[model samples]
Target: MAERSDFSFLDEAEATCRLAMDPAATGIDLCLILERDALLPAVESIDAAGFFIEDVAVLDVAEGYQARYHFRRFDTKGRIELRVTAPHDDPHIPSIANIFQGAEWHERESMDFYGVTFDGNPNPARLLLPEDATIKPLEKDEKSRKSYLDLMPEFTIVECAEGHPIEELAAKRQAEREEAERKAAEEAKKAEEEAKKAAEEEAAKQSEEAGEAG
Candidate 1:
């Protein structure tokens, strides 16, 4: 796990998670899940550490809307995701556009999709969605998100291992294949036995006919 020397200023906030660094794949090293109030302080520390805001995205989960602030440094390799959850009733958080100009567009897009109000976002214009659309399509569980199979091919998160969520659908598929092979082998053995019985009966009848003729 790559340590963030700058995070010490945040007073050991409990929501931090250390993920193994994978620069080649995703380039993410750390994930800090923070409350709305801790958002500014955490980002301040990140900025001091020389990280720049990459993008801001929003996701609607069972708990509420999740605002994800993606950050990375040009001089450094790994990326960090700073996440904050807002209640379903009132999803809002302070905007970081003032700190990083790139966050301005991202915040607007997130607000457009998930109805997360960025408190100080300057424009807050609808980037992609229709202006008249009142419903946040992303917030509706069925509308915007795809199933696990669609996203990961065939994996479902059933448990966790070594601090990562483990998908067990592959194991379930292997069991199904084993069961099918077992049934096929049993049927083949049964057919072989029936053929042997028929051959033996034929031999016995032929011998009885020969003896009667003699």
Candidate 2:
């Protein structure tokens, strides 16, 4: 387990994750945004650092304003995430992808529906909304907003290990363990066969001597 750091610096957002720094910064505060499967361990990792969870916050949308969850995190040094929400009518949040390069997709997503803009993002292209698709699907009324999280299937939270992707590491470990076990079983079988052959030879020699004496 990694040791926790002092996270008192980030209480402004409701549920922000103080992402551990990449090569770019010594440290940074990331405002997290949640889609469907983007929570899980990443959420817990941020929460373990002592961030607050705010179920409500205000967003500055170009068309108008809206209310949504706004969480905050702070005092972290590496890959971290902050989750925020906006209203069904114009869902939008400030993009921190510039501060944390990984925020590009999240900012793009915010733009897809809420039409929010990241102040200085290089590529705020469509994310969830596909190219040339004529549907702002997430734009919602009160009833539709209730099941936004549930409706989205691609919400699996993936940890961004700048040095190592968790998926590859896990597969490697599993393969090593299996290989070791297979070798051990083969050695044991070979030893057992040698012992059995030796015992059979000894029994045959003794019987031949007894028959000659009789």
Candidate 3:
């Protein structure tokens, strides 16, 4: 039978300590960090196992995927992390922000920066970006195209600037308009000169006709 030990929440430094305790934990390993959407399922798994889960956060990756949900609990003398792998395309998991208030900003930050949609988050907007600002919708294709309507309407919005931002796009269009106007002006000036020349020739021909008739 498994041992029954009390569990505690791990602090930031303690989390690092737990990582150092493990040799196979490469690059600051903290066991498994589940996605926010998978938080409930993960806790259910642990609860079913009779294990305790304490805290949760959005795993921060410097260069790789960041939408990964990271949760942990302090076991006997060590910390065990809870993690889940979200689907690559349309990758979304359940949100546990309801259970843990701390997950609010963590989930918001993840959705804001990484662009992952949480199912039951209180606020899922880009917390880092300005409220009205829209730079990184966080849900763009590989090429940065905004098509992220995958998140539900009721879920919290953690605004990352503003999604579908067209400020730069509008500027580009303005520049194009100015260029077209300049071209049109040039064409009009040329046409005016040609018309003036035709009028002068017509007047000269009329004078010659009058001289001949006289």
Candidate 4:
């Protein structure tokens, strides 16, 4: 269980996109769903916090192309995930290679597999696929794609400083989960009461029969 204040450096970054998540559930302490423009400042703040960039990954979903940046610190117990989405038609995200040089190859790998453009990358060349390849082999078709929220159902957005587009959806999903749990509990209590009543009736019947026989 990590608090927002645990990562104080985020105050200098985008606080509105900050989310405190359950580390036990997601294996991530904090998550930030940042806009394209806010990505660089967030990364800079993480670096200032003594966190190193572990990996940069891209996911093709119904919403768009999601770029995930994983960060971790040796002395800390928490891991942070920074997410930025780009439209499917315009899959362009600002490159973090300038801040973390190691991110250059990771971003290039993403470009090769998902056709994502890492703008400002010193060298935007394919790492795995052929240079002449035009198709992104890892991209999913429209029918097979899943929304970002759908894939990350375990993440509950507890706080949002500024209203975000996905805040409403997260709230709705949380409400639905609570309602389902409430209904299941009610059903269990009702079943228990019914079973208790049936047992009482059976005992009364047997006692009356025994009294009449005596």
**What value does the lDDT take at residue 10 in candidate 1?**
37
lDDT of 1: 0.69
- Model 4 per-residue lDDT tens digits across residues 1-214: 4333357677566645667778888878788888899999889888877889899999999989999999988766888899999999999999999999999999999999999999999989789988999988899999999988777736666567656756877778879989999999999999999999999999999999999999
Local accuracy of candidate 3 as per-residue lDDT tens digits, 1-214: 4332333222221111121114144322244333344357555554544444444444323222434333333433334454444554554757667765667777776666555667788887768877676554444455543222221111111121233222333345568889999999999999999999999999999999999999
For each of the candidates, give the backbone clash count.
Answer: 0, 21, 26, 0
Q: Considering lDDT, where higher is better, how would the candidates rank from best to worst? A: 4, 1, 3, 2
The lDDT of each candidate is 0.69, 0.47, 0.49, 0.86
Compared with the true structure, the alpha-carbon lDDT of candidate 2 equals 0.47
Q: Model 1, poorest ten-residue lDDT window? A: 151-160
Candidate 3 lDDT (Cα, 0 to 1)? 0.49
Question: For every candidate structure, what is the RMSD over all alpha carbons to the true structure, in angstroms?
Answer: 8.6, 14.0, 20.7, 2.7
Off by over 4 Å in 4: 1-5, 156-158, 161-163
In candidate 4, which residue pairs clash?
A: none
lDDT of 3 at 139: 40
Clashes of 3: 26
Against the true structure, whose lDDT is highest?
4
Residue 78's lDDT in candidate 4: 80
TM-score of each: 0.59, 0.33, 0.39, 0.90
